[model samples]
Target: MNKSVPANVTIVDHPLVQVKLTQMRRKETISSDFRRLLKEISLLLAYEVTRDLALTEREIETPIERAMFPVLRDREPCFISILRAGNGILDGMMDLLPSARVGHVGLYRDHETLEAVEYYYKVPSDIADREVIVVDPMLATGHTAVAAIERLKKDGAKNLKFLCLLAAPEGIAEFHKGHPDVPVFTASVDKKLNEHGYIVPGLGDAGDRIYGTK
Candidate 1:
């Protein structure tokens, strides 16, 4: 983990995660492979992000006997993906949390100011009452993340976590500055953002690669 990254930020550094990330970063990786890798990595990332979820004991009867089993105390957590690219991660996350409610926050960054402008936003009606995890493959400039978090907060979401496959130090800093209470999870925090505000060495525009737009 980079010392400069906020304490709240967690880097999932498992060997599998690293290998998958490396494969995804290669320019030659096809859209199908890229999408598959993203989903695989997102499931790995989901495990770490949901580690602290509250659990409760439940009385259940097994085939042989009755016993108390531990189960999630709350209803399934809500997942909010940040538009087009976020959908890639959402699929993997759902693999782990099949019952979780899903939401989408559509935002596009203004190339000139590097600010996020929201074009769409929607979430579960009970969003305010459940744990909410925001998923995006890359956290580059962080403006889009900050904007998305702000919107979630405004809509009464209190418990929030941001998850990404890769993050830039600049984005992490900006994110923490805007929403200090929200923790961030990522597979890797790369060197830094470039002049154009993209994470250096990041798996290029996640949406483009995942959907073969480029």
Candidate 2:
């Protein structure tokens, strides 16, 4: 992690994560490969982000005797996808947590203003009680994430975390400013954002790559 990144951020620096992230960064990687890599990386990220989930002991009957087993103490968490690109990461995380509730916070960044404009928002009615993990592929200008989290908080969501594949120092800083209490989880934090508000040396536009829009 870079010194400029917030202390609240957690970088999943596993060797497998680094390798797949490097492959995703390559321009030669096709849409199919890029999408596949994101899914694989999401699984790895999901594992790390959920590492601190609460657990409790449950006594169950075995063939010969009773045994105490560890099981999640709380209900399945909810995954709030930040629209199109987020769905890529959301899909993989869902594979590992099929029972987890799903939500969407639709937002788009204005080209000239570079501000996030929300069009829709929906989540489990009990969002205030359950853990919430917000997923988006890139943390570019950070406005989208900041705006999304703001909305979630307004809807009574108290426990929240942000997850992404690639991040920039600028984005992380901006994000921290907005939600200092919320932690960020990512595979890599890049150098900076370009003049166009894109993460430098990032995997290009994640939505474009994921849906072949470019």
- Quick one: best TM-score, which candidate? 1
Query: What TM-score would every model get versus the actual structure?
Result: 0.98, 0.97
How would you encode candidate 2's per-residue C-alpha lDDT over 109-161 as one tens digit per residue? Answer: 99999999999888899999899999999998899999999999999999999
Please give the RMSD of candidate 1 to the true structure: 1.0
The CA lDDT of each predicted structure is 0.93, 0.92
Clashes in candidate 1: how many? 0
| TM-score, prediction 1 | 0.98
Off by over 4 Å in 1: 1-3
**Could you tell me how far off, in angstroms, the CA of residue 212 lies in candidate 1 after the best superposition?**
0.5
Among the numbered candidates, top lDDT falls to 1
